[model samples]
Each structure stands twice: as C-alpha cells, then as structure tokens.
Target: MAKSKKKQQTGPDIRAFFDSMDALASEKGLGKDEIMEIFRGSLITSYQRKYGPDARIEVTLDSETPAIGVSVHKQIVEEVEDPSLEITVAEAKKHREDAAAGEELVIEEEPFAFSRIGATNVRHIFFQRLKEQEREIIYNEFSHKEGELITGQFLRWRDREVVYVDLGRAEGVLPRREQIPRERFHPGDRIKAVIKSVELRREKSRDPGPYILLSRAAPEFVRRLFEQEIPEIYDGVVEIMDIVRDAGFRSKLLVRSNRSDVDPVGACVGIKGVRIQSIVRELGNERIDIVNYSPEPAELIANAISPARVAEVRADSGTKEALVLVPDDQLRLAQGPDNKNVKLAARLTGFRLIVKSLTQFGEEMSSPEARAQLEQLFSPKTEEGAGEDGDYTPLTELPGLSGRLISLLEQSGVKSVEDLVELEPEELEALEGIGKTTATQILKILEDVVSFEEV
Candidate 1:
C-alpha cells in the first residue's frame, strides 16, 4: 500500500500565528485584539531598532487576511534630503497622480525584508512579547485567587522538597513546610490546596514571573475544606467564626448559624457524622472538633475546654485576659498533657488564659497580694510613653525623628511609631547605627512627644 502524501503547507505563515493567538486567547482568557495590537507595536519597534528611527511608520492589518502591512509616511519635498523619510515630488507622483510638494507620501513596505539582523530582531521581539503577555495573563488569572481553594494536578517536586502543582494556567508551589506530613502527592494525582499568596518571584538574570504559593497546612486550608464540604457554610446560613489547626493532628472549628433552629456544629458534623468524617479522612484522619460559637468570651472559653468540666470562667474584655477554674480532678484534662488543650483554646479565643484547679483559685483569692496582682492583670497594660494609638502614626509623622533615624527605622523594618514601641532600649541599641545614648534619646523623644500631644 502506498503511503499517503502529506500536503505541503503554503500561504502567509502569519495566518498560523493568528490561529495560535486565538487558541491561546481562548485558553488564557486574554483578549485577542489586545494581543494583536501589542504585536503590531512590537513589529514597529523591531523595525525602528534595526532601521534607525528616522521614518514615521504606520502599521495596519488587512481586513481580508491575517497579513500585517507597514507604510512609511514621508514628506513629499522638491528635493529628497533623506531618502528614508523624504521623497521628491516627482517620485511621489509615481504612486499618486496629483502628488505635490509639501504633501505627505505613503510608501507601502514589509518590515525586515532587506536585512538579516532586522529579521532576527523581529523574531526576538515576537518571542519576548509572547512570553510577557503569557506572564501577564497568568498573573491576572491567579492574583484574584489568593486566599482561595484551588484544585491542581501534582507535577513534581523541586528544591527543598517543594511540590509544584499545575494550577491549570499557572504553577503553584507547596513548600515543604506548608505541606501536610501525612499526605503525599504523585504525578497526575489531583490535589487540592489553598493559595496563600500570589507574588512575583525572580531568579538571577531571568524575567520575574508571578507564582502562586500554596499551602495545605494553613488553618485557612481546613476552613476552606469545611466550606467545600458543608453547603450551609458555603451559603449564608452558617458562618465560621474561627478556626485553628495543628495540621495532620487536630483542629478546632467554631461556627455560628443564622437560623435559631439550626445547630451550627451539627450542620458541620452532618447526619451520622458523615460530613466531618469526610473532611477528617481528607486530612489524613486529623481530629476536628466542631463547636458552637458564643459572643461571650467566658462562654466561648468554656466551650473550647469541652470534654473537660469547667467550674467557672472570669474574663476581662479590656485586658483580653481570662482565668478558668476546673474541678481538681478535671484540671489535668482541661490543660491536657504539655498544656496542649489550654494552648489551643487560647489561640482560638485570642485570650490570655490561665487554667487552674478550683482549689488553687480559692487559695490565690485568699492572699491579699495575690488578689491585688490579679486586679492589676485585669486592667490594660498601659504604654508608659507611647500614644494609645501610636500604631497608626507613620515614621515620618513622628516629632523629632530625623531623616537619618527614619532611614534606619525603614531598614530595620520599623515603619511606624508602633514598631518602635515593640522594641526595648537594649533592642534599639542593637540596631546597626544605634548606640546606648541614641537609644535612650529615641525613647525620651517618643515619650515627650506623645505626652505633649496628650496634654
């Protein structure tokens, strides 16, 4: 049997480019017209770079075909001072019957037809622009997905054991530290992760491109998983108040339901515990506690220490401090081994919590000094010299702060007055250009300036 002859491909190869452009536009959600406009500019740029930018040029696309045409508009003069940009009235009349001196003459031409270097420049411009447009399309697509759950294909592992997942349009990196230890990914496996951030990452001598940093270990990842699993959470019926997790180990999820009849915890738990069980399996059997959220901090703290009986809780809203009392035998359970239970509760509640047995609470209350110390703890810790809202003050707005001090503060990552408040005198002295005397001066100026404002 004779082999079928392959038909020879012919016509302006530029048509193939337009076809490819459409395909990429469809896939990347890019505008075809915008890309073609960029390509036209690039062609003109390549022509200018090669042919001394003396001639004014206009580029137009043929309506009937994919071919691009270039026209050099030259001044029709009596004498051609520069052949590239000026044409004699006699030469202009060859294209136009009534061409006259001082009139503009249009010379229809193709770019890079005469020089090899010009052709090479055009080729380079095409590829460079193509790469840039691709980067922009990817960045625009993924930037909107920051802090969102995305499904991706597992590609391969790279430096530091980070897994690169193909997120359809862009690649996302799941750093080893941000990956769940209990989970493993294989090539072609469908994996789900949360996009922690989208940022431009540059390597040596390479164009910076936006990359997605993904995570499965973040607390938000578990929250997103619950959002995916439970319809009530996805809709407006239920809301997640807070979530805290120790990836691949345990997680605490607090939820509230809008409807009085619906239990937020039960909605997440599902019938026969199927909903939470599915999420637990996805997390490699990580234990999840679905709890009802209470606006009251004491009640919330009490709920957080569930499975362990709490006798009472005293919470001060101002100081964000809390003291929990449990029965003597239940104290160990409330605190758990290594104080893991109380620590998780504190993180979830955003409260400084102290877990004590009922007996210890009574004994502490029995002493006058101890009682006085507890009262002090209940009051807000006052900043000695800083403004109550110094955190809102920019470094440049601080009184008595010199340009040199501002530069140093910027270098040390202290951009505002609040950052300075976080540092001790010793820590301030540890800065590159700061001495003990300078540290003391900075503190004194801060105190005096903020105090004067108050007065």
Candidate 2:
C-alpha cells in the first residue's frame, strides 16, 4: 500500500500590503507598539490558516514602522527527508555557518505569492481579525461606561428607527426605543448620548459598533444633563434626588440643597433659567420643571406637581398612597393632558398619587355620600387593634427605629403599631426629637413593617 500524504493549505502572502500606520493608529487610538503587537498576532493566525496547523512559524513586526516579516522555523538535519520541516546541515550552513544537526534554522520568505487568490483571502482574514480586535477594545471602553455620557456626531439614519453616532474610536447606536420621539437628530449634528449598554454582539446589528447601545430617552440622560448643566449640582451643593421624564416632551427633576441657604431649584434653573434652558435646548426644547425635593413626602409630591399648587396633601404611609388637592382650575395642569403630570410626579416621588380638585376634596371631607365613596375607594383590611385585622404588632417592633423614636412613640400614647400608622406625617414630625428626617424614616419603616404574627 502507498503511504498517504497530508494535504497542505496555503494562502497568498498579504504581508506585501502596506497599511498606513497613521490610519490604523487613528482608527483605534492605538500607539505604534500596540498596532505592531496586533499585526504580529494577526500574521501568526494567518500563517497557521495558510500552512498546516502543526507548522512552526515565527513572526516579527516593526514596532516603529509599518513593516512585517515571517519565518518558517525548521530543524537542521544531517539528511533531510521532510523538506517542509527539516533542512540538511549543508543547506543550513549555506545561510548560517554555525548550524548544527539539532539546531533550528529560520528561513525568511513569503509562503505564497501576493497575486494569488489566497492573498486576497488572507487580507480579508487579517482585516476581519483586526475588526474583532477593535470590537474588544471598544467593548471594554463602553462596558465600564454604561450609563455614562458620551458626545458624538450623528452619522446617519437607518430603517427610520435607529440613529448612528460616530464616537471617534467606535460607532454607537441610538435604537428607536432609546430615541426621543419628539426630538429629531439630523445628520452631522453633534449629540450627547448616554451609554445604555455594552455587550459582545452575537448576531449582526443594524448599525455599526454592534456591541454598543446608546440612549437619549433613558431617565439617566436627563439626570446627566442636569448634572452637566447645573454648576451647583456638579459642585455637590445641590443634589438631584430623582428625575423622571416623559422622554420627548417633558421631564421632572427633584433637587434638594445640602446647605440651608442654597436653593436647589434656583441653582438648577440658574439666573432667569439659563442653566436649565441650556439643558432644555439640548433636549430639543423639552419642558423641564425643576422642583424642590423635601424630606416630607406630601411636600415633595406637591412640589413635583408644579405649576399646580396643592391645597393639601394627605399621605398614607402603610399604603404608600397620597391624596393631592388642587384648585379646580389647576386640576388640568396638575394631571396634564391625560394624567401625564400626576403620573410622572408619582414616579418621581415614589407614590401612588390621587389628584383631585379642591372642591372634590372638600366634598369627600364634608359629604356623607362622598365619604362612603372615599371609604370604598381607599379601604383595605386594617390590622386588628384598629378593628380590621386579626394580627398586630406594637410600633416599637418597627425595624431600625431608634430607642429615641420608640420612646417618643410610647410617650405619644402609641401603644400599638396600628396607632402609629394612623398618625399623619405632620403628627409624627411633631413628636419630640423626631424632626423631618426621623419622621421620614419612621414613615418608611411603617410602610414595610408587617405585624410579627403576620411575619
């Protein structure tokens, strides 16, 4: 039987192609050293694909210039049998006179002609490898930057749903779901977008930088804009407690001052609304209402529903609910065109807000039929001591309630947790040593505490 021979796959030597060092460095923001390393690794991979997998190869790339060289490493032998892997001592000595039988010899040469179809394939393979490298670099950069702000040029539109941005070293996508529906970003316009996500793409995405996802609609974007536009917020004198947006048309920002003298809302709005105006322009003239954040839930919610003064706000701690009273004329503004304002205010304040006109609030307060309706609308099974629950725990059992708070509760004749739940926020604040902070904390504690028996 004849000995079977192994077939070898060879490709065109694309090393002859010159890739401008400046072009590569500019594309990835990589220095010459990094580019050379990438080139060497790419050559080794290309060489292995062209030659057999077991073929021994050594590749070198010029660190200071765009030059690459590859060599096949073969052992010097007294009598060569496999010419591809072994060189006769006499033949090795022709190049390196010190060559010995056991020593290795490196022959500098191109494995295939540059004009061969294999060369084109090798070039394509090399560039594809570079693309993967670039993907890794950009992915690493954006992954740590998710939710961070990035400014780039609007590249183009795609499918009428996505916008592409040219971030110097990588491309980013503004998916339709992340775009502001009311804001139009034109080609070549400069944009500042928030990094929504960064991941290694498995399937081909519609735009470049398939691994990058940017967002203009994220609430974080509005927060970032506020941070960028407001000097006091950036300086930490004013803090943004929370922000909620209707995405395109409007946004609500809750800001509070750390110092007693600095007005958070005033600082955010700047003198005559200059700072917020800059942010509003960036958001395509989106209406932004900067409201003061208070430790008091009712006050915060009342403020969140700006342009509509609240006659009174009644909050239920255990239910995490609030009743918002507005003048009949302001009811439309409080609830917006379709309850949009109240809905956003609820989100910003973390409450289930019930908005109503003052007349309606009064009717419920004074009318018997209205009282029954209110009872039906807001009624829930109350705990036993108050007459509706089978199980109950004392207010002292509230978690994280300091001894001082418990002492105050006990002194106030609050024997059971149910009794504490019935006190309004102002009543809680009025207790000795229970300031606004302690009152807020107490309300939160009660909101989540279930009776020991129920637990």
Candidate 3:
C-alpha cells in the first residue's frame, strides 16, 4: 500500500515537467508542437544512451499541463532476460489477468531521477536538438532570398579578412573576395549587400550556423539600384536592355522605353540627374551611362559614345562591322583615356568599332594618287580634267556610278574608279560599309563602263 501511494505522486511530477516546457515555448516564441517534438526526441536519445539500443520508451507531453511521462514498453515473454525490453509472464499477469506469452505490456515508471552530471547531460542534449531544429528553420528561410538585396548593420571585422553583418534575424558573412577594394566597413556601419547564397552545415554542430553569403560586387547591385531610383524602371515602363559594368569604377546601362512617349534615358537620369546621382552616391561615385537603346547599330553606337559627336557611321551589311567617324577635336573624348570609353561602348552596343578621326578620313579621300587612279580606271582614253585641289573630281561625275554609291565608295577609301579597279573582291569587302555582294556588284558596273570605253 505504501508503494502504491508513492506511485500516485509520480503523475504530479510528470505534470510539472510539461508545465516548464510550456513556459519556455511562450518565452522563446517557439511553437508548442515543435518544442514537444524536441522534448520527445531528447528523452528517447537519453534513455537509449543509458539503457542500450533495444530500450523501448515512449515520451509524451500532457495537453492541459506542463507534465511529461515516459513509459517503458515490454513484451510479456515466458521468461525475462533483458529488463529493458522483456518482462516475466508472472509479472505481466499481475497487471493484466489475461496477459500471455508474446503479448505486449506497458509499465509506467518515473525516469530514474538523474544525478547532477546526468541532469546536465540531459539538458545539453535537449538544447542541442533545439539548436539543430532552429538552424534548419533559418536555412530554409534565407535560402529563398538568394540574389536579393538586403540591409544589415556591420557587426565586426575578423582577422582583417571577413566582415560580419547583423541582418536583424541572422548573421551574414561578407568574405574578402566579395567586398569591393578600398571600401571601408566599421562596427555599427549600415551596409547593404546582395544575398549571394545560403549554405547548410551539419545539423548538430556549433562551429558556424548556416552560412549566409553576402556580396557588394555583383552586377545585380547596380540593376537593383536603378530599379529603386527610377519609378519607370520599377513599374516596368522602362526595360534594361543590357548592362556592362567595370565593377566599382563605371557601369553602362542600355535602357529602352516601353511607351512611345516615355524616354528611357530621361526617366533614369531624372530631373537635374537627381535619380542617377543618388545611385552614384551609394556606389562610391562610380560613373553611370544611361543610354537609350536602338535596334540600329549606327544609332546605338552613336549613343553609346555619348557627349562625343559622331561625324559618320559606316556599317558593312555582310560582316556587320562598323567604323565610327568623329571629328579630330572630339577623338580624345570619343576614345576616352586609354581607350576606356570606346571599350565600354563596344561592350555596351555589342559592336566592334574602328574609331577614326575625320582628318584621317579626309586625308584618304583627298589623296592625289587616289584621284589619278580614278581617272585612269573610269576614262583611260578621255582627257584629264582638273578641279579643286590638285585633281579632285567628284566620283559621281564618273560614268555608271550614282551619287549615293560614290559616297559609299568614298567612305570606303575607294576615292576614284582606278582605286576600285585595283581592289580584289575580298579587298573591297574589307573596306567599311562594303560586303562581298556589294563588291561584286560594283566590280560588274566598273567592267561595263570600261567595255564601253573600248567601243
């Protein structure tokens, strides 16, 4: 009767255990269902480690109270060998009169009250399991945010290598490779980064939680800035056709207007360049070129080399080559220092451009040898005529050539008919604005004019 009364007190202790868990769940903002699961898992793990692998135990939390109960289940066999899994048939019959061999029986028992060391071990296991579940939750939450821009506060710098940022809910790492050169980060600095990736680690380890990779060097950073600064771009009225960036130095954006009345460049530049200036300030004074997109290569190239006047744009129909002519005074501006402007324009327009000064074009056009060659090829039997300069004759005045075709030939260095006759089809095609097909047509026209001279 004393043993029976002692057993009656065990239920109250189980109820108190669960009541503590409920309070913890409320304070930590953890869900009751998740906490209950973790508690059950910890109980099973602790029991197995102490009693061996075959130990059969069930752990449950009381629905209305903060109580936990652990029941050891055993098979009622004819004889008891393992105290953890099997019980004697006589012992089982004491609890259930109809119990028989191979029948399963459950014995309700209080967990052996743990010693100080054992209690610490149990608490450690419970917290470890909870931490593992929390990491998994964090991993799933941030994984979906990859490639998005996030705002965080600088926490600290480690080994002068990695920068740690506190992202409100989680910590993120900014590796040296992802940070821009010369950019400084200090403790408590407000920083922005693009979520490069999220990497999961082994569940039960504490070396570092699931890694959140952050970057300030990605090209998308500029695109995201434009989207934020330009209402038209954010609302989809302006589309970014292409972007070419030199990381922190300069970036070029080709934008197109969706509506006929909306100017994409004007929208991005804003009034007095306020919109673009805001973005520039954020990027450490990086230069931004917001050029209008054009389907025509000539127009596109012209816009790409902005603030540099284009005297002429000659494109080869077959080879898709373009020669951009700028006045001699504007050559320096067109090509920029060390050809950076031209290089950026090429990348922005998707065209391989040969930039030539107008003076150079004029030199090739007005050469005396070129005029004499033209006269011999067009009219070998006719008298030589003089015009402005030593022997400059309008190429259109030559028989069998239209003014437009003459202008095309002049732009291509074929100053006279003699120059045209000296060129092979391949050589002619190599000139700006000329293709194999056009070369063939021009050669045919020159040959007919020559045959007429013989007659």
Candidate 4:
C-alpha cells in the first residue's frame, strides 16, 4: 500500500519534468532527442564530478513511461580489481540472479542525489550546450538568407554606433558604415535591411552568436528590393543585368526582358509609377534610374543617363570608352549632384564616360587631339560629307546647321542624314524644343546639303 501511494505521489512530478523538458526544446528550437542527449551528457558529467572521475554512469530517459532513470555499470569479477569499475560476483548476484564472472551488471541508481555544486554544474553545462545548439540553428537558418531583404524591429543602438535589430530568433547588427546616411530609425520601429553576411563569433563570451550582419547601403540591398517589389523581375520575365548604388543618394539598375511583348523599363515603372514608388519610399526616397539593357554600347550609354537627355553617344568598342554629349541646359543635370549620375552610369555600362555639351564638343574638335579622335572614329566607316548611297553624314559635319539644331536632332535619335531623312517635317516639329521655325530651318539645311531624287 505504501509503495503504491509513493508511486502515485511521484508520477505527476516525473510528468511535469518531461513536460518542462519539452517546453525547453520548443523554446530553444531544438529537437526532443537532442535535448535528451544533452541532458544525458550533463548527468554523466555531474555524476563523475560528484563521485570519482573513474565512475561509469549511464542515463536512460523513457518517454513512454515519462521517466528518467540513472544507472551505474560495473564488471562482475570473481575478485574485485577496481571498486568503481569491477564488483565481486557475490555482490552482483545480489542485484541480478545467476551473475557470472566477466559479465557486466547494471545497477539501478535510485534516489540519485546531487550535491549543491553538482546540481549547479549540471545546470550550467545543460544550458550552455542548449545555447550552442541554438546558435547553430540560428546560423544555419540565416546563412541562406544572406543577400535577402528582411524586416525587423529596431531594438537599440549599441555604443551609439551599431544598430541592433531583433529578428525574432536572432539579432542582426547593422554597423554605422552600412546604414544610409540620411535615414534614421527610432526604437521599436520596423526597419528593413539586407543580410550582408553570417558570421560566427570565435571568442568564448556570454553572447555566443553566429551574428547576422545587415546593411541598408549595399548595392545588393537595392537589388533585393527590386526583386521583392517588381513581379516581373521575380518571375524571370524581366532580368536585372546589373545594379549600382550611391546608396542613400541614388541607384541605377540595368534590366532587360526575355519576352518580346514585355517592356522591361515600363514593367519596372508600373502604371503611373506605382510599383517603383514603393521601392523608392522603402529606400527613403532614394533616386532610382532603371535603364533598359541594350547590346549596342551607344544606346545603352544613352539610356543609362536618365532624366537628363543625351544628345549623342559615341562609343569605341576597342577602348571601352564613350563620349556622351548632352544639351547645354542638361549638362548640370546629366552630371548630377557631385557627379553621382554619370559615375553610376559609367559603372553600369562598363565605359569611361566623358560627358560634354554640344558647344563644348565642337570647341574641343578644333584641337588636334579631338580632331584626330574624330577622324579615327569615322575613318573606317565613312569620311566627312560622304552621304552617297548606303552612306550617311553626321549632322555635326553638315554645313549651315546650328549647334542647337544638331543637338536637338541628335537627342531625338537622329545621328546622321540617313536617320534625319526618315523623319517628316511634321515629325521634326513634334520634337521637344523644336517649333515651326526650327523645323523649317532643319528641312532647309537637309535640302541644301543633299541632292534629292524623286522616285
């Protein structure tokens, strides 16, 4: 009756112990078997620490019975050699009948009591192992997330420099260098950043983390934002060729479409600029220029300089250099603040860009070096004033044409008399900065230079 009463009394305590173990596994994001193995190792360490180091101990945890049982193992010998490892057969038979020499006997260790120090040591080891496992879990989870955009709550800044964000299971560190200079965040605010890297701490410290390093200033951050906000990019209908960023100031992306029906730039911009506006607001209203990818270097360079009209792009395939001519009014705009626009365009297009106005290029053409460059540029193709069959003359080389008219024509994708002749007088007047007088002057210049034959 007393044995039955004692068993009933301790049943709930064992069930409670297993329940807490399950809770710990869930809290630490560890498997139940992993927790049990860690607990078993801790028990062995604590038992060896309390008794002699030579003690042979085994821990058995039964989930079906919801019980934890500890045992001491000993070799049954005719004569005892070591008190901890070997026991006399006479003594072994007391626990197990028919115990023979050279056989091993396992004795159930009931009422397994730990000293105060032993209990503390076991607790420390158990939690430390749990922490290490948790760190590994977090590391594996976030490692694949590198170069991906993630949203987290701003916790606090460490040392007033590094911003710490709580990412649920892990903490992300955004150093001051990776933050956009113009952006600010308050505590408890939701902040979005890209995972720059996953780093493991080597030092034995209180915080054992495979830390997630985050960034808002990286070019990859902008790339990820575009992928997230643009459905075509995500679905592979439109592909991003390259991304370059001056981080909080500006960014440029070169994109192309695989399908003929889809326009890459128009798709990224969305109707009325709704899609790109979301990405811009996410980036703290950073300037974003989505350039259409072109195999022709001249067209690509012209498209790269956006919001600022390009009058002409003369690209040399050999030297990977380009001369970008913009109108006088668009010179400053093309160069952008601190020349970020041109610099980013150069980086994106893989060209050394020399941005110039029409007057500036014309004045430089008077120099011998500029003249030699111009001659070499057109030598293999056609000579000056060579507008014969299947040949074209540059509008700049045409006589009696003002620089403004030449620049306006070039800005409208008309580089030579061949391209100009294709446009009607009405089409010429429809161009920006061109009215009835300018259109009449352009047509008169074309007529005087070329002998037109009626078909």
Best by lDDT: 4
Question: Which parts of model 2 have CA positions greater than 4 angstroms off?
Answer: 1-28, 61-69, 74-115, 208-210, 364-369, 372-455
Of 2 and 4, which scores higher on TM-score?
4
True lDDT of residue 328, candidate 2: 86
lDDT of 2 by residue, 1-455 (tens): 11112223232333333346547767777776676666666667667665456567777554334345677777888887776577788888776777788887776655343457657766676677667777778788779998899999999888877888999878888888898886677878998999988888743653444468899888899988877877788889998877888877679988789999998878888778777777887887878898887778888888989978888888765667777888888888888854678778877888877788877677657978767755644556456534423233565567888777788888877766756755668778888778899889888877677432111
Could you tally the backbone clashes for each prediction? 0, 4, 7, 0
Instruction: State the lDDT of candidate 4 residue by residue for 49-129, as single tens digits.
Output: 654578798787877686677777788888886787888978877877777888888776543356677678889989887
Q: Model 1, range 345-425, lDDT digits (tens) per residue?
A: 878898867788888878878999878767766655567743434314687777788999989877988877856764657
Candidate 1 — which residues are off by over 4 angstroms?
Answer: 1-35, 51-55, 63-68, 77-101, 112-114, 200-208, 328-333, 336-338, 359-455
Worst 10 residues of 3 by lDDT: 1-10
Question: lDDT of all the models against the reference?
Answer: 0.77, 0.74, 0.75, 0.81
Better of 2 and 3 by lDDT: 3
Candidate 3: residue 328 Cα off by (Å): 3.9
Of the two candidates 1 and 3, the one with more favorable lDDT, higher being better, is: 1
TM-score of model 4 (CA atoms): 0.73
What TM-score fits each model? 0.70, 0.68, 0.68, 0.73
Clashes of 2: 4
In lDDT terms, how accurate is model 3?
A: 0.75
The 10-residue segment of model 4 with minimum total lDDT is: 1-10
